[model samples]
Target: MSNEDVDSRRRRFLTITTGLGVVGTGFAVAPFALSMAPSERAKAIGAPVEVDISKIKPGAMRTEEWRGKPVWILNRTPDMLKTLPQMDKRLVDPKSEVDTQQPAYATNETRSIKPEILVLVGLCTHLNCSPLAKLKRGGSEGMEGDWLGGFFCPCHGSKFDLAGRVFKNVPAPTNMVVPPHTYLSDSRILIGVDKNKKSKKSKAKA
Candidate 1:
């Protein structure tokens, strides 16, 4: 082949290869960029949720899902707090008898760090269904009126008061469950393992 012809062919080949190289680089870089960014599941799993309990107001309950279960963080008003103690007679386990229903630290009135802030798992003891937040006092829902506030499950119509106590005559045999947790600061709650319990478990495993 002639030198000029051969030289022309080489130049054309180099140009095509350069273009293909750039295209391949663009494809590879796009995927790498995606890898560097956080996925939605990753963000949800480990993300620290910030909730402003300040605006929950009086007699109002706010519910958010954490770790696949409904985590209700309620701000009980003065009236609601006053009403909590009076509903015992109407409950199936007025004394919070079902010990496993709540964390050890949350066995008191309101079931929380502060009397005003209540946190609980909203599932009913019957068939693992979620309960509805009842903001009123009475109506033979099986709970007392002085009832103040709480949750009612529609699946089996199981009822739980502000303290996670199960009302009498409900399908749920026990009180609503409270997950293992602790207050991170004043308002932040980490709801999975109890720090103390986890240490004990790890020691036993080791």
Candidate 2:
């Protein structure tokens, strides 16, 4: 080939190769850039978690994650509710006196906003082990008799009553933590925030 023709072909090849390199780099970096960007779910880590409690059957429980921690929402039966007062004498903080463990709105006998719905962080206070739900009264769960439905930590033999009350003489120091929560509706609850803020917002709008 002539020199001029050869030079023109070389230029064309260089331009094509450069365009291919740019395209290849863009394809390689696209996934990396996406991985670095914060996802919608990640941004909601510290934000409120809303749950629908309507389908949660009585005496059953539902669990969700908030701030990378497991949070439980238990529907207490009338019988389960009665067991709280009975276990008070055996609980370390029966009345939830330790304010830091839960929000002030949940510092009641049931440790909940509603009388029947109990919300608590599922982690044990002693070592952060997740407790297993043992919701059977006087049933075969290692505890012989008078075993009101509650949670049992297999990790270190810690026990929590149905109301999340730490039994006396247990390894756990206090009751399970109650995350700040509020009832958006009869069957919907928002965790990680209290109802006071919602009420305040409503007042401001009025």
Candidate 3:
């Protein structure tokens, strides 16, 4: 072939090879970039979880999952409400003084927005173990004679009152976490979002 023709052929080959290389790199990076982004299921898992509290009759408890952790909702009877103050002397943080353990609105005697409904993350603060719900008073759930119905962590013998307050001298250093939450209505509660913030957002949307 003539020199000019050969040069032209070589240039064409180079262009085609460079184009393929770029295309190959794009294909290789696309999948990786997509994988790095979160999936729909993952987004759903991290999103706020709503719970219906209407059917959770008084003295009964309901369990739900939020961000892969168990969230408990307890409809406290009048008697259960009375038990809180009685055990204050034996609690590590009876008033939910640890700010990180719950939202500002929940920093109360019951650690809840409503006095009769208690919400808490079910994991033991000492170790992440799920505690057994010993909701009945006395030694019915392998508790001591004075046990006033709460949670007992079998992993390390930690005791928590019905309001999720860590008992004095327990492995858990603080009260169980009460996740940010808001009541959408008398029967519905939305977890993972603060009540005040949700109200602000509703106003903004309007």
The most accurate candidate by TM-score is: 3
Q: Output the lDDT of residue 72, model 1.
A: 76
TM-score of each: 0.65, 0.75, 0.76
Clashes of each: 1, 0, 0
Q: Give the lDDT of residue 160 in candidate 3.
A: 92
lDDT of 2 by residue, 103-124 (tens): 7766789988788999989999
lDDT (Cα, tens digit) per residue for candidate 1, span 95-141:
56566645665767666667887777778888988888776677555
lDDT of every predicted structure (CA atoms): 0.68, 0.81, 0.82
| Alpha-carbon lDDT of model 2 | 0.81
Clashing pairs in 2: none
Model 1 scores a C-alpha lDDT of: 0.68
Count clashing residue pairs in model 3.
Answer: 0
For model 2 the TM-score comes to: 0.75
Poorest 10 consecutive residues by lDDT, candidate 2? 24-33
lDDT of 3 at 66: 78
The best-first sequence of candidates by lDDT reads 3, 2, 1
